[model samples]
Target: MSKKLNIGLVGFGCVGSGLYDVLNRSNLIDAKIKRIVVQDPKKERSIDQSYFSFDINDILNDPEINVVVELINDSASAFEIVSQALKKGKDVVTANKKMLAEYQAELIPLAKENKVSLLYEGAVAGSIPIIRNLEEYYNNDSLTSVEGILNGTTNYILTQSNSGIGYEEALKSAQELGFAEADPTLDVDGFDSKYKLVLLLKHAFGITVAPKEILNVGIRGISEKEVAYAGEKGYRIKLLSRAEKIGDQVVSFVAPHCISDQHSAYNVHNEFNAVVVEALFSDKQLFYGKGAGSHPTGSAVLSDVSALKFDYQYEYRKAQSNGGLKYTTDAFIKVYIGSKYVNAIEEVAFYSVEETFQSAAYSFQVGWVKLEVLFDLNLNARKDLSLLVLPDSIQTEKGLSELIEKNLFIYENQN
Candidate 1:
């Protein structure tokens, strides 16, 4: 008979507790939770108090523990804990995207050096298994683009606000329903999605660029007028994280986009997430599932733990390959710029103005503009301005497709 794997769990919050419950109820894997570390020992929990520990060393220093699972909120603390566990030669699993996005360059190599597994299936889109697919199925395939709705809180709020509910009220409803935190800045401000995009870059294109390098705009500035305008134009407003290979550069960004109902993203609503991977031979493949909630996220984390039983680890072949891919935010694109500050939108030179709408409260214009020029404008920084959506245009779409094909042909010929 196989020996049971001993686990040292960190954090007793939503995902941690859910993982404990799942482990207790399931008999699929021979695993046991030996210890749990949390911030507060006095805090009430449904699990037995005997399992709780105030110090992290109890888990990190314990020689018997074979696996360490970190699911904390603070990225700094998470990084420290994960680093320590890896250094101690314990296989590690975490659901913290921010820490991974920021420190993966250092952490990934460390794990490889130590020959310890560092798996994070719960980091990107919860319960989707997108990471595993990227590492396994698409490893040999030449991918052109990866785009998706990556956040549940903003998606839920956008769905509510588009249905005539006010923005503030929609946010309140999300908070009450436990879909959002009290301070929803990370999720609503696009930082959450940006972090996920950074991780996606590593797996999709074998690139690791900082979050600040990408153009990340959120749904916080989306108003009723913008939502109504999207509806009228046969589009749905969605916060999308997109990375596309053009020439030798990968254009990546996370922002609210106006997608037509005919598009697959329009069908993904509320707290659900969907990822579309476009490859050379595969064309397009969609991955959809519940993106948030304790059970869903916990299920992903448990999958990583189960994989450890068989000594599975991410190969990260693309990252190690000489892909010669570069990251850039210098693409020419089309966008809907809206604000009470009309002068702000008019400051840049547009290729062509598609339409213009004005009201007592705001003014908006749809036009073709260079992404770098728009990024220079910094519309997201202004309280009076908002870059509403990045919509697809016939000219821009055709141009990007051609560029992708040209780049792929060149890559193939060179190899």
Candidate 2:
């Protein structure tokens, strides 16, 4: 007969409402929702209105509320709520990746100083359990690289486009299906994936970097020609977030990549997410699941609540170790560039040209190039051009081509 844990939930949006339903319907965890804070009290909700409160203090200042779950969309408000909760010596759980990515360095230490646990398993790659796995199981492993398809909205749009639907139509369908928002900039423009990548870097490599410090390119400018080229070459166009350790340097970038079917991420489509972790001894391990949606995200939040009962918290082992890993964009790699402006393609000096194609609509070239040069170009900022994808054949300065070779082997070995 364990005592029930009291929870104060903020934000009764999709994930928040879903969590309320989940907690009410299940006896899996001995937890009760004590108070829920929302911005608007007049807003219609299926749940009992008596459980709702307009003031955040009702939950934060309440000594009986031992746990606070912040699911708000506003990062500033979320930061305030989470910080105050931790300061009050109450455990905090949140699904706000943006806030955590931007202020984790401060928030993590605050939680530690107050001796309160802070958990956000729902923040990145929803329902994948990646954060917990990284903080726990792979804590001792020497992780070399982590790459994945992290955004569900873009993935769903890409999946639809691959099926012969136009990009605009696919996006429209995603919005209608509630997979995307009216303003899909965050998801479509790579900001969502960028935030997730930053979190992954923290847990996987103990590297903390601002989202802007990493190269984040989205699929906004991708055309049918580029998609067709990928299909013709036995490759799938997937928006990929990748971080790799080369010697003492750590390189991370998010962009659309032309991955072959042999790659684990090739088949991940339509509101799904997948992460591939490459470690020293384990070789490669893949984690796949639904990236978003109310129920899946709510399930992750509930898991964190259950974990709190056992005093579970992130160890942050890599951050404590003297890993000497520094962020760098100087790594050499292969890339595909498509643009109506040929001068854009010719702007940089390439190491080698693998393939070239031309159509009335666009001209594309595949070649080897320095990552720094591409970062400097910032092709994502140019409306006239699209940086299609960085292929798996990328080579670094230290001549570590084993990943490419292994990828090829996997492709050839596949039935």
Model 2 regions more than 4 Å off: 1-3, 349-351, 358-360, 398-415
Q: What Cα-based lDDT does every candidate model obtain?
A: 0.85, 0.87
Candidate 2 local lDDT, 100-125, one digit each (tens): 99999899999999988899999999
Stretches of candidate 1 off by over 4 Å are 1-3, 349-352, 358-361, 393-415
Worst 10 residues of 2 by lDDT: 392-401
What digit string (tens of lDDT, one per residue) describes model 1 on residues 229-270?
Answer: 788888888899988888777888888888887677888989
TM-score of each: 0.92, 0.93
Tell me, by TM-score, which candidate is best: 2
Once model 1 is optimally superposed onto the true structure by TM-score, how far is the C-alpha of residue 403 displaced, in angstroms? 12
> What pairs collide in candidate 1?
none
